[model samples]
Target chain A: MTVPRYTRLIQSLPASVPFVGPEEQERTRGAPFAARLGANENVFGPSPKAIAAMQAETLEIWKYGDPTSFDLRNALAAHMRVQPQNILVGEGIDGLLGYLVRLLISQGDAVVTSDGAYPTFNYHVTGFGGIIHKVPYNGDHEDPAALFAKAKEVEAKLVYLANPDNPMGTWHAGTVIAQALNELPEDCLLLLDEAYVEFAPEGTAAQVDVEDPRIIRMRTFSKAYGMAGARIGYAVGAEGLIRNFDKIRNHFGMNRMAQTGALAALNDQDWLAQTQAKVSQARDRISRIAGDNGLTILPSATNFVAVDCGADGDFARKVLAALVARGIFVRMPFVAPQDRCIRISCGRPEDLDLLAEALPLALAEARK
Target chain B: MTVPRYTRLIQSLPASVPFVGPEEQERTRGAPFAARLGANENVFGPSPKAIAAMQAETLEIWKYGDPTSFDLRNALAAHMRVQPQNILVGEGIDGLLGYLVRLLISQGDAVVTSDGAYPTFNYHVTGFGGIIHKVPYNGDHEDPAALFAKAKEVEAKLVYLANPDNPMGTWHAGTVIAQALNELPEDCLLLLDEAYVEFAPEGTAAQVDVEDPRIIRMRTFSKAYGMAGARIGYAVGAEGLIRNFDKIRNHFGMNRMAQTGALAALNDQDWLAQTQAKVSQARDRISRIAGDNGLTILPSATNFVAVDCGADGDFARKVLAALVARGIFVRMPFVAPQDRCIRISCGRPEDLDLLAEALPLALAEARK
Candidate 1:
């Protein structure tokens, strides 16, 4: 007749996930969306060689994946020009964030991030009973100086900043971010999420030395390498910090096919370059579509663009609802001011054509 | 110049991984082993349909996995004769264990397990700063009464019991376990890990109602389903307990190919039946080989056998070391009494032949 007793921290936490996935939406709607442009996924997909490699490796799925992620780490180290010990290959950046939060954040500990930054990071922070101190976005961009100041004020153990930010699709140059790191509080580690760095302009990656213990950069193959479903991401940090992940990480967690696919994806720089070109072309096409509807598009350095709906958040919500009703799946920012824009991921010509056709009708429906 | 301030718990934990993966060993030896029998992986591999489904899903790698795991959960729910809310599908049993520990065991919280049982579970408990109270095995079998008594004595929040257990390859009947539940301490949850239940005798699965709040049973696709590398496992429990996992789990941590592959694997029970039969045959063959080598084997209900080397812990270690050196990747128990037997995973016919060739030579080298 007795039940499990959860910890105080677990008991106090709300049982809400960070975001509801598109599949859940499709299931509830009893229909699938025509254009899957809401999740900021690279619709151009992974390299042909990566697909073949994963397919080939599928036969070897009987064995557990290498806990060390030796080959992938070495290849990544070679590419990043750092030692293998400085990189930690994990299930994904999301999983890595969870571990990092667990490592540093105890109950009532402070963490700092932008108010409208990655909700997943906030989810992990609050999940561990850490108090999240948020700074509002300065315009459409995350103000690093404000976030750093908040981190210092709150005595936060960690502060998060995403370069080529999500939802708004705006970015700071590598040099701009590199200089901003100086303002970061002493003992407060900066989580520089570069999940969309692959699609950003040249010199967008911060020029920080691998020996700098103040920052950990998270990069994912999901964005530009186009293996979002594979769930492979890495974090580059100081040797000691990276090695500390071995203490609590699910050592044998990576999928075997994913390990091989990501390795192949990393090697095929030509495909990544081609995907970049497609993303650029698609971004331009998306802007044209938005402009035709008399909406201005944000300057995006990521694979997605934010198109202003030329109204308040309430009006934008109606437009978003209409678009979803029309089977054009797109999302907007959770925080206000930015929520007036609808964020759309780069898709193939046909998928965007669906979006292009639906927007005008969706706007008309919203107006009515 | 200040480094990150780690939590007291994180500062205390050593940065040591639980088990060194076989791939790491292969990389170290500069050659792959002839037989990989250490990790309890199914040498027979997953269903042909699972492989094909994963291959098909690989093309959709640009999309993130469904955070809800809706299809997989619904399928598992129907198969297990339970409602969807009563189940929680996770990365694997390992990943689920980590979450379960976090839910119940806070710093200095009491947890109980057999000393020689699963190290990964112990690793998670300790990593979370939970104080583990060890119960010794009664001869070869884990004594349920002792574990229950210990939980009460220590005011333990959780007690772990893996039926048809790893390393020892032993089990009690379902009725035995069901009857033992009455002795479980009040407020203590029994983690009945059924990772090896598919190969066990009839009635080995406990006859507990899904509504029972005292126990949560974990099952995996890694064993009889032969999809270890794909990382899919589920936990069946009371609805309240099951739903609580949503508070902290990585919503999109699962690989997309794994989700589809697992669904296809669950539907094809024929492949599972074939795998169970093959595992049984391989176990018998392993026993025969041990007998021919003038050694005895513990009766096993798992996809592996514990062959008694007719020696002490030191001698068994030598034999295991020799076997690995001889290119046969067999492992042994970490604790005494169980360490007298070397555990060998069920391998293919050709792999067994390699094992047969290597055993005598390894023993000879060990005797030296």
Candidate 2:
């Protein structure tokens, strides 16, 4: 009955899951949600060509995918306007962030991010025993200048900034991020997470040199390409930094159909444009829905809208719970001030109609 | 031009790949392989049911996979006859091995493995700054007794053993392993990688209790199930240790189609048995091909055969290069004595026909 001896660090760490998935919630409730938009997944789906390509490649699933992710890297390089060596494709930004954290953070290393920015990034940092310094959001945006100042104060090795940030859906223009890089500390690397860049306005992607080692931009097909199920994401950075990822990466850890599907998705610009249009319509519809309910919506450049719940975190939580109770899946920011709102992702008209029907009733229930 | 401040351990590691896929070799040669017999990939392909399931689920690739992997875990639990709490599904054995290494190994921690065993295991151990103690294989078989003795001598926290070993295609009966457990040191965890167990003879899977805390059994869909590109594997260990994976796992990292396809694959045992029969026939055909070329093949309980080149490591390398030149993708073990054997994975009858045609010419090239 003797137990295996785990390492001290692992022994000290608490068992944690950054997010409990919708499927688990569904299982617990013994029923699936009517509208599945809580996780910010693009419900519209991937390009038809990607679906066709993946279906075609299903028979090739016996063979291991390219260890180097050769084709995907070349395609992403061409798309990002960078050399192939500047891009590293991985199992979504979540997996890449874990690898990045492992590469930089040893025990007691300092890292920085907005207090309520992506929790998965924070999980990776803390898992590696890194000390985190969090700066509160400036208004609804993740304040890049504040994050850099905190990184400097802590002598952090890494700082994470999500452009067109999650939960809030607000973003700074490319020029703002390009300027904010000047305040980032000497040894600190800015993790510029652009997971929602495709849904954001033009110029939202920072205009940094691909040779800038100070920042690595992570983008995902999970958002605009509508391939969250594919689990593919990539980071673009200075050639040398991207090369360093090979030091410990699981070389053959990629899925073959994911590579095929993502490549097809990248080549279908018309389909992407159509998806963008639909997302734009859904965003507008969601805003109107918020306004009709006498609630105000935050300005958003991403697919999701944050509707102010007219009170504090507690009230917003109650509304969120009520919506969940009514079979409309939605989420809210976990931090104060920002937590006064419920975040709703751009869904199909039918899905949003469910939200429309549920909100007022949910609000009245919350008012109780 | 500042470089990212990577951790000292990461800085110390050389960028390494355990195995390069056959696709990379084809790209380098500007030709596709006539016989893809390397990398232990099944050429007969996955179950038709699995392929159909994967194709059907392609359009649903818009949502992230069930982070909990609820259905797959429950299915794996039912198939393995273990409690669901004892299972931990992950991104293939490579990815799961990485997580396990991270959980147990710190810088300079002692670990043990056979010298010529799976390189990926060594890669993960070294990546985590663990000190690996290698014991030589005894008479072409991985000496479990020697591995356990070394684990005791070095006070290793982890000992890796691949039953139905790769490269040599050798295996011990399950009862041999159950007896070997008595020699394994207390406080040491046995990482029993059974990736090829389904291809091996009956009783090849060890008879250890699912509640045993001293061992963790890792199996994959990559081998007999023929879904290597899906990047799916699972570990069965004691409930508490299996629960520990939550502390650092990327909860939502799984691909949706993979989960669906693997569940379908698991449910089709009839297809699995048919694939096993095909593998057995291919192994016999490979042996006959080796014998026709004045070579001998190792007795295998796996989906591959190791043909003795009757020469040194350099000779085997020459033969491997010659085969590659002839568009035959085959590999040889890297360590001494074992290096005299070029490993050939079971392939389709047509693929084996190409191997039969090329072996004599490759041997002549090696002699030259």
Candidate 3:
């Protein structure tokens, strides 16, 4: 059979999805999930003020959002204590990652990331035909030194790290990351993902100067602001680095309500503090529940907590399946060691109550 | 002076914005426009049902949108009379264009479009280092035969065409485009943009078999559906071609409220028809206004009409400037000949009355 023509690179690549959303699983099961902790989405929801702002802007959806995202950028700059020129907002951190990789990785260029760190970054690099040099995570933490060494060894143009990271819910101190910055390859830039940073402790975020071109920090409203459905996120870096996004981005990809909603979300810091307190309380509840069930709870600096299932990857997989069967949706790390644990996002009390009732029964069923 | 490091390509590229938004212009002038007709946004707004749907969804904004966009896809499939597998929803046609380019065009890969076609597509191609080959429009129309010839000449992997096109508001019969498809280069695929199809004559949109891999049709709620800021669009193509987008798209980019809004928008055909009637009346009024001022209005199948100012591109530029100075936001084409005209979007009567009131004085001032 003859194939329709595609570029050599595209032809060589396999068509694969990065993540199977919980919605797809629900569709297949013909049932809605009892608890949605799989995607790390905020259960507390966006601030009421943000919702009101977005609702007010709904009738104005006929107009395009500001291509520059000026209002949102100015608000973000003020909130982050950085100049507006240093901020670049996009569809989300995911969209920003795609742009960042496109800006740096050329065909055949080398890039580095933790072996299982955000697969979407690797997808972008590979889509551009960039060669990937992955360093395995050291223990549960992403080893920045190993990533830096790999970058220098492969002469990589970019490196990726997630602080208060996903999957394993592990974190490295901001000072440790700052120290690691010194060892980064001279020509390589670090893409520091802080998607969960608002839920992280103070100083857990790196203190790199906004003028430093060697690093760009990404943050999202999806977690702390509880506006995942708004698809708003921003990157902060040196002006020169940030400006490059304009050369390639979809100038109008941003939604207008997202701009309005995100601005209101930023303005209502009281709601954010409330969400943080809720997350903190929920985390404790999750830890207690896991401990009572004889599972080991990993230390978490994120909105989610990872629990070691006291078994291998396959047993953990069984537990995950059982949870899903019992109408609880959760996710796990993809690789070894880390795969022995399941990640549960902090949920509302009702959702957590559902999880608490289901976990013991699911574990017992999985053991059987 | 020492400069911080960047990837070689990043250093080689100039920082440029593809579009300067109306908001930015307003901010610079310290005032908003009296009439918002510049960007072709539908001032009449989305269906009340759609707005209500979005407002109701604001409470659910804490949850990440279904990554698969399952319900919206099902609704769109039913509305488009196509199978679910043949459609891929994205963050407007702009986001879909980026993903399609990533799937087909590689570094140095050739691409073709009309000389003054959509700049966002050109931006994406250049961002990927694709070699651009432009075919000038035959008169004001995007000549299909000319586009096919250019694709063959450059051995391009992709060719772009927008029916009921932007900037000029010209269109070709669907039969003409369908006949031209057979002449496309063996390896090339045609990207048919039907963004304004909702306002166009019934026969203007080409009817193609969804199983045909030679072409893909893009549609958006950002036009006649009056939801530009919703950021929702979809492409219909062969299943194999559509599935390839999964490899590169930001799967979770679809906003939750946007999905609800679009579904509601699609279900409200009566509102759409009412919007179309308003658009037609507005277009007629604009033409009459242009005729009153001794300007020739181009026949339009779009919500906007282009009026030839009976002078050179420079004079048209002055006229646009004078109108903007009078708080009338308007835009013109970038190329020669076409640049002698300015495009105005359909707006409410009062907004058009403001345009009417400003045009004569602006013209006299421009002449002086």
Candidate 4:
């Protein structure tokens, strides 16, 4: 029997997932995780108002969402002080990344990212047949200067930098990123992923002009807004660049509940402030728990902390596996040096108590 | 100020939306549509249980949806009597079509479709730089033989056919479609979009082997399941073809609420029967309305009916515009012959009552 033909690029790609979800892990383990702190999900949950909004929209699920996402875009524009044309909302930052890569990366084009940064971005670049250039992070933070220099050297079509970077939970100030933008190659676009910006300190957002065609900043409701399950995010850039997303995006991809929930979340700044404060307290508690266990925690600007196991990558893997075996879901960096740490998202006190109870046993098991 | 570089194909394409949603028209006119029958959405809404499931999921929106969609996929596999590996759930059939086109259609690859059947499919094909070969619809129904012949003639990589088709709301028997498969080129994959199959008459779904590598059938929760705004759909095909979607699909793209809602929807077969009956009644009412206006209505096996205006395409266009002006939302075909009719969706009696009240005036206005 003849198999259906796939494109040459598709033929070359192995069927794989970038990250196995906690739910998948739970299924394999035959039980739910005791502390669901993996995947960097905000365990504090979405604002009550956002949940109510989504619930209200549940009855109106028959009508397809507005393909243009008009109300949400207008709300975002007003909130961000940019024109609606400057924004493009999609399924999530992951979905928007796919569209951006599809628009700019033809086969054989070069793209750049940190060696162990967001794998989903790398997946998109490679999926579209773009050759990827990897740069190493400086200490725990993404070195923007190194990324820009490499982009110029490689003649890269796109360069990805995530502020308050994942896995390490490190961040650079907004002004630093704005200054680094000057070194960006004129022909290369900077894909500044700010998925975690909502949890970072003041001035964490890049100060680049909204009309700057050289950069597109992506923000998500998946993090601090606590709507990761809703799968909603938006990209902000020059109108020319933003409008190009229309050429390839699934125009009706946004769920109706997501659109409504995000708008309500955006409107509730008080809830955002309260959530941030709670995350901050949880981060302190996690740091304390790490210190108590004789482990060092990386200073985190986001909701997650990378606790140094004070050993090599192999030891860190054992610790991560042991934690999972103990029904605590925590992930770690995939590359070396960074892989010496285990990444843990901040959770409520009760959840953290479970983590605190599991960590010592996990460490002892790894040592044995 | 240097502009970001878009790929050559992207540069060649104009930024356009596949469909102008009813919401956009409402924004342009500054008034809500009195009868929203334009987008073929099931106005009866989703099952109450589906709504409850979605609402329950709202509070847990912090966690990302299961990337594998294991629960939903297993549920669908059981419902369809197919293996879990045979099903691939996606954002919607629209998103899946984009992925399918991307998998098979490299630049300049030839694809076949009816001239005016499903513009979104055409959009995806062209977005990936596929060359489209269009065959005219045979009478009101999509001509499967003509499409297969065109596919062979052009050495097309993909051939798209929508059964119980959109806009024209016409369908052929499953046995006829199954027989037409013999004429399809061996190397060309048949993309059978069964988006409306649930509303079609019994024996409408083609009896194809699930292991048939030559075809993939797509179904959606947006139709008889009444969850269009939820944005969930699935494709069933040979295991090999189904596995290829994992190589390119957004692994975490499914919304948690959507996954829960669709599972609830699938479990509620009683709701499905009631919805089908409601749609059949609405179709009869619409047919009677067409008769009252001295118009001929096409025989419909789907939720909508195409009413022939007894004039040319231009007259039909005027009638559609008049209906829109009278606060009734309806659509027509884009190509000739079929464009001589306006498509009206199955709606609640109250919604159709508004349509009934406006049809005579719309006809009078079009004549003027």
Candidate 5:
């Protein structure tokens, strides 16, 4: 049989999923996860209004979504205080990352990110044949200065930084990021992922001029908005850079329900504020639970807490495995030092009670 | 300010939407289209069970979908009588086409499709920097023999054939396609897009081996399944080729509602049969209306009929514009010969009633 011809870059790339979803884990385990905390998905669920909007759209599912995503983008633009031309919505931040990488990274182009940062971004860079330069997290934070210096040194086309970073759940203040942008290489574009910004403190989102061509900031309904499965996200940037996304994106890729759901979610800021408060309370409970178990919880600005297991990566892995075995799903960082901690998303009181009950047993099992 | 450094290929490409959606036309005209038959979307909508399933999923929209798409793929496999390994589900057939083109087509690589076939497929080919070799439609049909000869002539890596083709709504028999496969170049892969096949007559789908390495077939929930807005589709191919999609696909790209919705729709074959019958009746009604208006309707085996305006491409263009102006949405093919006809999607009786009322007036306006 003649083997099908794949592009040389594609042939060289590994067929891998960046993260195995919690549902997949459940299937493998032959049971549903009790807590469902591993993937950093919000457990508070979407706003009731958003759910209603999506349900309303379910009956009209025959028509393709507006390719321009006009209504959603317009709402987002108004909410962000930017022109609609400054925004480009897509399947998710994951999808937008793929498009951005494809637009900027030709084969052998250099890109930079923290070593243990969002692997999906790394996956996209590598999929597009971009050479990835890894910068280690500075004390669990994505060191924007270090990333910029490296980008300048390597002449990298793109540098990725997730504010209120994942796995670690650490963040830099917006003022710090604003200062760091001055050090960014002249030719480099900053891909600022703010997936967790809604859960972060007020000043965590950088005050960038919408016309600044050097950076694009992406936000998603998947995080604090509680609509990850809906897969709606948008990037705000200079019109020149944002318009380039239209050159390559799947124009009709946005789900109709996603557009409607996100618009409703955006309109319901009361639900958002309420969810944030609930997340804050849950974060405290999780921190206290970790402390009660003699574990140190990393200060988190996002929905998840990373607990220091007081040992190395292996011990943390054992704790994570034990938690999964106990039906409490939690994940951990992949690289060293950071890998000594296991990440847990903030959940409802009952869900976190399951975690609280499981943690001590998991720790004991890991120690044994 | 420094210009954003897009890839050389991206720099050369235009920021174009492959299809201007009906929503966009409504935005421009400041009124919705009365008929809504332009994009081949099923006005009958999805199975009520599918809508209910999606509605049930709306409340649980906080979780990301299973990255593996295990359940949906397995269900599709059972429905198609193939192993789960044979299927690869995606955001839509459009999204899958992008992935397929990206896998096989590197810069300047050769690919073949009929000139008036799916524009989105052609857009993907060009976006990947693939050199396109177009074969004109054979008497409004996608001629597999001509396409195969052209593929052989150009040593094309990919040859696209949409069985029960789009825009023209023309099709060839399964036996004819199977025989044409004999002439297919050994090295070229045939991309059989069966988006409209669910509405095609029996004996239309080619009975190829699921393990066949020379061809891959794609189907969608968008057409007869009435889930276009849900944005779900899948491709069945050799395990070897199917596995490569994992190398570059957005792992979490599939919307959670789409997964549940498609599975529900697939299981409700009774609803599908009813839809097919509705579409068949709609096609007949459209043909009769065309006859009354002194237009000629092509013999259709799909959800839409191509009505010859009986003059030329320009006349068809004028007719389409007149229809749009009369609040009746319809489309025409973009290439010659085929462009002389306007494509009207199967719609509800009330929608076709509006079309019936508008046709004579539109024809009169076009003639003037």
Candidate 6:
């Protein structure tokens, strides 16, 4: 029974999914979700023009997308006011993170991320056999100072932070992050995941010079742009760092429609503005619903809100399960304290109305 | 001056493009191609229905595609007459190859392929630290006997073959492959890339036996279907092997529009039949054109034809260069003997007319 050998690292990996879909849970529960509020996907949807462009491009699905993503890159550079060299587009932050991890972290290389930050990033780092050093979150937000300290102590090659972060829906000012960058270990590179940046305050994102090689910023069309299904995201960094992605990226990996749709989405700022207004309105609705249920909603500059359940992690888990049972699809944080809250994505008025209706019943049921 | 420390493997590898794209070449030459025949893309285009489906899906680009790819997989399974559990849909054949290589080939593991079969497959194995053993082509076709012998000798984990192959436009009959499959080492998996199989002669594709663990058949929408840009491909294998991809794949990587376009493409066998007819016509036209130029055209079942210049590889190189210079983009084999032939993809009548007009001038120039 001799079998083909997998690499040592691959062999060591457990065949596990980072998250299960709400759809799968529903099949088990024997019903559909009353409110699709998990996964942090934009419920506001993409602009009509962006959708039209993607739909139109769909007709040409027989062709491979431009390998260089030339047109999209050119458009993005103009929009960002940076050279195309400053950006590298990929299949969402998840794909880019995997490539980056492969590029910098080999077996036993030191990498640092906040405990219970983005699990997918940790998954990539671990998948490559990098030795992960987890620093605890300072309060509910990812702590820049603690991350820098740990990176220096471990002599880490990479450090990760998510501004306007997930699960907790908390953020740090750009100035705070910039200060941390200045104190980073000379050999350490900071991976700034701004997947939710478009939904954050103006100065939440640092204005670091593109020439600075110490930091790479990741942004996504998945958030406010409501194109999560498109799987389009990009990284902005110095030319030296940016060019490294070509060493291993799937050169023709981008979907044709996504490349075209993203370009169109970027150009339609009016739609983005309109979506932002919807998101704002939805956020208020989520907060009000949580308050009505006597739960506390954390301040959020993200598309999702983390509502504190006024209980322990276990108690909050019960509430989340009850919500799922009651046809409300919601998720909570993985770590304690943070897990004392449940996360909900902003959706349509009707979707929030469903959430508002179910939250009270679910909470009462959970308590019983 | 300090930057993040890169992994040893990253440090060892040079940032190299295995194959330069036509677009990049065009950028260098400062003009677009007159006849885009290189890269073996179907210039005849995909089904009108596929295009229409994609266009319709474009409006929903913001929604991430179903991670399970339920509809597409079920449709593909029915098309292949296999259980959906036995199929794994991916970004494309390229992406799937990369994943399989990563899964099976560890550092220094032996893997095998024809010397010039597909560089991208070899690139994936090498990128994952697998040692590649190349068995030269038997005549101008992939040498099945030699491949089995080499795989056995090296105890290779994977062996890759492209039927009705690219660059050479040749194929091995399904019976020949089924015979070789019997000799593969118990743990050695055969990755049969049947990208061009749809256009190949009947009995060229191995009869689907999804339960066969020894071989995985890869198919793509990019080639005969004309949806290369859509980034859709699928692999059919035993359930165990197919399920393993879920352990590590980006669950949300599928683009919604791509799924729609691919589904529609699969359903429209009428368009597929028409495209095959057009490709056959284009192949005949190309061969006749080559014969008029005192060159021999290789017998081709694939959408592309390989024309032998009846001269050295150097002569073929010059003719290719001349064609590129004149804005008729085409490619040749990378190694000797085969390199004496230039590969031309099937295109529309006008596109082939451009090739016909350009071939003589290019040949004459090359002769000079």
The candidate maximizing DockQ is 1
Looking at model 1, residue A243 earns an lDDT score of: 86
| Candidate 5 segments whose C-alpha is farther than 4 A from its true place | none
- Candidate 6 lDDT over A111-228, as tens digits, reads 9998888888988888888999998887898989889999999989999999988878899889988887878998899999999988888899888887787889999999888898
lDDT of 5 by residue, B196-258 (tens): 999988889999998989999999999989999989999999998999999999999989999
lDDT of 2 by residue, A120-227 (tens): 999999899999899999998999999999999999999999998987999999999999999989789999999999988889998989998888999999999999
* Native contacts kept (model 4): 0.89
lDDT of 4 by residue, A305-329 (tens): 9999999999999999999999999
lDDT of 3 by residue, B1-368 (tens): 22334456566565776789999999999999988999889998989999999999999998888888888899999988999999999999988998888788767889999988888888778766688899888888888999999899988889999998888999998998998989998778899999998899999989888888889999999988899998999999999999888877888889889999999999999999999999999999999899889898888999999999989999999999999999999999888888889999998899899989999998999899
Q: For model 6, what fraction of the real interface contacts is kept? A: 0.72
Model 2 chain B, poorest ten-residue lDDT window? B1-10
- How many pairs collide in each candidate, listed in order? 0, 0, 0, 0, 0, 18
Residue pairs with backbone atoms closer than 3 Å in model 5 (clashes): none
Q: Give the alpha carbon lDDT tens digit for every residue of B1-368 in model 6.
A: 45857776666666886677777888999998988898888987778887877777655555567788888999999998889998899989999998888888767889989987888898788787789999888789998778888899998989888887877889888988888777777878888999999989999987646787778989999998898987889999988888878766777788877788789889999989999999999999999999999999989879899999989899999999999999999998998879989999988999999999999999999999
Per-prediction DockQ comes to: 0.82, 0.78, 0.65, 0.81, 0.81, 0.66
Docking class of 1: high
User: If chain B of candidate 4 is superposed on the true chain B, what is its TM-score?
Assistant: 0.99
How close is candidate 2 at the interface, in terms of C-alpha RMSD after superposing the true interface residues?
A: 1.5
Interface Cα RMSD, each model: 1.3, 1.5, 2.3, 1.4, 1.3, 1.9
Candidate 2, which CAPRI tier? medium
Q: TM-scores, in order shown?
A: 0.99, 0.99, 0.97, 0.99, 0.99, 0.97
Rank by DockQ (best first):
1, 5, 4, 2, 6, 3
Residue lDDT tens for model 3, A256-334: 9999999999999999999999999999999999988999899898899989999998999999999999999999888
Where is model 6 more than 4 Å wrong at Cα? none
- Residue A226 lDDT, candidate 5, scale 0-100: 97
Interface RMSD of 6: 1.9
Name the lDDT value of residue B43 in candidate 2. Answer: 74
CAPRI rating of model 5: high
Q: How does residue B4 of candidate 3 score in lDDT? A: 35
